[model samples]
Structures are given as structure tokens and as C-alpha cells.
Target: MKIMVGLGNPGKQYEHTRHNVGFDVIEELSRRFNIPLDQSKLKGLYGIGFYKGEKVLLLKPLTYMNLSGESIRAVMDYYDIGLEDLLVIYDDLDLPVGKIRLRQKGSAGGHNGIKSTVAHLGTQAFNRIRIGIDRPQNGMSVPDYVLGKFHKEEQLQIQDVVQKSADACEACLERPFIQVMNDFNQ
Candidate 1:
């Protein structure tokens, strides 16, 4: 079994915000595969789908961003999934918009959710799919920026990124995480 966890805050206000890109990717995958993430268990909203003959669990942590680790830990523990069987999707402010970084292991690089997750899992070596949201200008608070919606011009590009991230997720499920990372993280 494989678990793909997308981290984001849940609610109307979080829609289309930079912080919610991971959620958007999961939503895209759900739509593409026609699998509704209406089931609630393991402390999250998730759906079980088959990808290439393997059962894939798609999870959107509903505990919001700060305490997102709870959902991840709960799902993994309940299913007895190893850390290697997990792939976390999240937004990254350090990278430019439209870029992606899929890493096998790394530090959170200042992401609070990832930081909390590292604390819970006792490792920085889990697989991660980092979707770039771009950094805000000088004097702009990161939290505020990430919590805000994108401009009209940025919307289409963001949508494209979301869809591509979904494809990357599928690719990871088909093969190894490194193959997807090497292909997408260029």
C-alpha cells in the first residue's frame, strides 16, 4: 500500500491560496481518476484508488497546515505503512512559481507543516513533492502571502502546475520515487 498525503488548510478561505496547492493537486488527481475523496478515516479526507494494479491511498490532511502531521502519522500508523511508502505534497516559497522539486529526503527548509511532520516521524528523510509558490517581495509576511490567492495572471500557470503535479504523483506510483523526481525536478 502507498499513501500520498497532500498538506493544506481546509475551508473556503484557503481555496486557491498558495498554501493550498498541494490540496489542489490531490483534487485534480481525484477528478482525473473519478475517485471522490469523500471518505473520512485515519484523521483525514481520503480515497483509495488503484494505480497500475497497486492500491494507492490519496489523503488530504484536514487538521489544517500547522498540525498537518497528525493526519499523516495517523494514516501511516493505521495502515502500518512504512515511511518509504509515503509521498508528501506541499508548497514551497523558496522556489519560483511553476517549478517543482521531488526529493527522496531533505529538511523542511522552514515549512512549519513539514517541520512538525519531521518531529512526529523522527526523520527528515521521507519523500516529498514540493510545488513552488514563489517568494513574496520584501516586507511581505510569508504566512500572509501563502494564505492569499494568486493574481489573475498567475491562475492559469498555477492550474497547469497542479495538473502536472498530479501526473507526477501517478508516475511515482507506477515506478520508483526517484524516477519521478528525476523526471519532474529538473
Candidate 2:
């Protein structure tokens, strides 16, 4: 089975914020594949279903961003999932808005969610999809900017990227992750 996790804070207040883009992508995937996130367990909301003949579990960690790894570890242990079968989706401050990057393994790069994930998982080797939110502009504080909602003009781009991210996840179910990265990271 393949596990796809999207990291973000839970609650309506954080919805649609830049930091919650990962959740947005997961929601898109849920909509596309008809996988309802109806189960609340292992510190997350998740659902299991078949996608392209592969068993897939889509998860949104409900422990918020910083403690995301706790939930992930619980689920992983319960399902006996390995690092190679995991795909994490989260926001990236370094990339421009609407852009997505895929990496098989790397450092956390100062992302608290990823840092926590690496700490709990005891390794940095895992599949990841990073959706770019860009760096804060106009001297805004990083936290405020990440927790802020996108400008109206950027909504279209956000929609496009969310759909694209979901598409990449679907592709990964059928093809090697590296191939999906090569095709989507452009």
C-alpha cells in the first residue's frame, strides 16, 4: 500500500492559508478519486481506496504542522508502511507560488513539519512533493505570511497548482516517482 500525507494545520481558521496548501492538494486528490477522508484515527483524517489498481491511503495530519510527524509515525506503524511507500506533500517557501517540486530524499531545509517528520522517521529518505508558496515580501514576518491567505489574484494559480499536484500524485500510483518528478517538476 502507498501512503500519501499532506501536512498542514487543522481548523477552519487555517484553511486556504499558504501553509495549508498541502491540505488543499489532498482535498483535490480526494475529490478526484472519491476517497472520502471519513476516518479520524492515528492523529489524522484519512481514507483508504484503490487508485489505478493500487491500494492508497490519503492522510491529512490533524496534529498541526509542527507535530505532523507524530501523526505520520502512528499511521505508518499501524499500517506497516515503509519509507519507500510514503509520499509527503507540503509547502515550500523558496519556490514561487503555484510551482511544485518533487524530491526522493533531502534535508528538511528548515521546514518545521519536515524537520519533525525526519526526527520521528529517523531518516530523510522519502518521497516528497513541495508546493511553492514563495518567500515573504514587504518585510512581513514569516509566520504571519505563511498563515495568511493568498491574494485574490493568486487564487487562479493556487487552483491550478492544487490540481496539478493531485495529478502528480495520481501519476505516482501508476509510474515510478522519479518519472512523475521529471514530468511534473518542470
Candidate 3:
């Protein structure tokens, strides 16, 4: 089985923020695959379904962003999923908006959610799909920037990225992580 986790704070206020892009991707995936996120457990909302004939568990961490690892660890333990079967999706300020980068394993690169995940998982070896939200403007704090909503133009682009990210997740279910990275990391 494979588990794809989308990290973000849980609340209506954060629904449209840049930091919630991960959640957006998960919602897109759910919509595309007909997976219903109807269960709340492990401090998250999750649904199990088939994607490309493989069992896929779609998870949205409800423990918020920084403590995402807690919910992820719980899900991993409960399902007995290994590192290789786990894929995390989140927003990245380092990449340009509407772009995505996939990595088989790497450091968190200063993402708090990734930091918590690495700490709980005890390794940096896991699949990740990073949706770029672009860096904050000069003089804007990182927190404020991440928590801010996108402009109308940016939102249009983000909608495209969300769909592409969902396609990437589907590719991961059918192909190896490395191949998925090579195919989607453009």
C-alpha cells in the first residue's frame, strides 16, 4: 500500500493560504480518484482507495503544519507502511509559483512540517512533492507570506499546479519514485 500525505494547518481561515497548497493538491487528488476523505484519525482526515490498481491512502494532516509528523507517524504505524511507500506533499517558497519538484529523499530545506516529519520518521529518506509558492516579497516575514492568500493571477496558476500535482501523485502510484521524479520534476 502507498500513503500520500498532504501537510497544512486545518481551518477555514487557512484554506486559501499559500501554506495550504498541499491540502489543495490532496483535494484535487481526492476529486480525481473519487476517494472520499471521510475518516478522521491520527489527527488527520484520510481515505483508502485504489489508484492505478494500487492501494493508495490519501491523508491530510489535521494536527496543523508544524506537528504534521505526529499524525503521519500514527498513520504509518497503524498501516505498517514503510518509508518507501510514503509520499508527502507540501508548499515550497523556494520554487516559483505553479511549479512542482519531486524528490525521492532529501533534507527538509527548512520546512517546519518536513522537519517534524524527519524527526518523527528518523530519516530523510521518503518521497516528497513540493509545490512552489514563490518566496515572499522584500521586507515581508516568512510566516506572514506563507499564511497570506494568493493574488487572483497566482490563484489561477495555483489551480493548474494543484491538478498537476495530483497527476504526479497518480504517476507515483503506477511508477517508481525515481521515474515519477524525473517525469514531474520539470
Candidate 4:
């Protein structure tokens, strides 16, 4: 089974914020794959279904961004999933808005959610899809910027990237992650 995890905080207040882009991608995947996130367990909202003849579990951790690993670890342990079967989607401050990057493994790059994930998982080797949110402008604090909603113009870009990210996830189900990265990381 393959598990796709999107990192973000829970609650309506965090919805659609830059920091919650990961959740947005997961929602897109859920819709595209016809997977309903109807289960609340292992500290997350998840749906299990088959995609391209492969078992897929779509998860959005309810433990919030910083403690995402707690939920992910529980689910991994319960399902006996290995690092190779995991794909994590999250936002990146370094890339421009609407851009997406895929990496097979790397450091968290100062992302708290990923830091927590690495802490619990005890490794940095895992697939990751990073949707770029860009860094803060106008001297805004990182936290404030990440928690803020996207501008109207940026929303269009975000929509496109969400679709692209979901597409990448679907492709990963059928092909090797490295191939998907090569195709989508452009």
C-alpha cells in the first residue's frame, strides 16, 4: 500500500492559507481519485482506496503541521508501511508560487512539519512534493506570512499547482517516484 500524507494544521482558520497548501493538494487528490476522507484515525483524516490498481491511502494529519509525524508514524505502524511507500506533500518558502518540486530524500530545510516528521521517522529518506509558496515580502514574519491567505492573483497559480501536485501523486502510483520527479520537477 502507498500512503500519501499532506502536512497542514487543522481547523477552518488555517484553511487556504499558504501553510495549508499541502492540505489543498491532498483534497485535490481525493477528488480526482474519488477517495472520500471519511475516516478520522491515527491523528488524521484519511481515505483508503485503489488507484491504478494500487492500494492508496490519502492522509491529512489532524495533529497540525508541527506534530505531523505523530499521526504519520501511527498510521505507518498500523499499516506496516515502509518509507518507500510514503509520499509527503508540503509547502516551500524558497520556490516561487505555483511551482512544484519533487525530491526522493533530503533534509527538512527548516520546515517544522518536516522536522517533526524526520524526528519521528528517524530518517530523511522519503518522497516529497514541495509546492512553492515563496518567501515573505514586505518584512513580514515567516509565521505571519505562511499563515496568511494568498492574494487573488496568486490564487490562480495555487489552483494550478494543486492540480499539478495531484497529478504527480497519481503518476507516482503507476511509475517509479524518480520518473515522476523527473517529469514533474520541471
lDDT of 2 by residue, 61-136 (tens): 9998999999999999999999999999999999999899999999999899999999999999999999999999
Which parts of model 1 have CA positions greater than 4 angstroms off?
Answer: none
State which candidate has the highest lDDT: 4
lDDT values of the candidates? 0.88, 0.94, 0.92, 0.95
Q: Clashes in each model (backbone N, CA, C under 3 Å)?
A: 0, 0, 0, 0
Q: List where candidate 4 sits over 4 angstroms from the true fold.
A: none
Residue pair clashes in candidate 1: none
Which candidate would rank higher by lDDT, 2 or 3? 2
Ranking by TM-score: 4, 2, 3, 1
The C-alpha TM-scores of every prediction are 0.96, 0.98, 0.97, 0.99
Better of 1 and 3 by TM-score: 3
lDDT (10s digit) by residue, model 3, range 1-186: 899999999999999799999998888888888899999988999999987688989999998899999999999999999998999999998999999999888899999999999999999999999999999888899999999999888978998899899989988888788998988875
lDDT of 1: 0.88
For 95-157, candidate 4 gives per-residue lDDT tens digits of 999899999999999999999999999999999999999999989999999999999999899
The local lDDT score (0 to 100) that residue 77 gets in candidate 3 is 98
Winner on TM-score (3 vs 4): 4
Model 4: lDDT to the true structure: 0.95
Cα deviation at 13, candidate 4, in Å, is 0.4
Task: lDDT for model 2, please.
Answer: 0.94
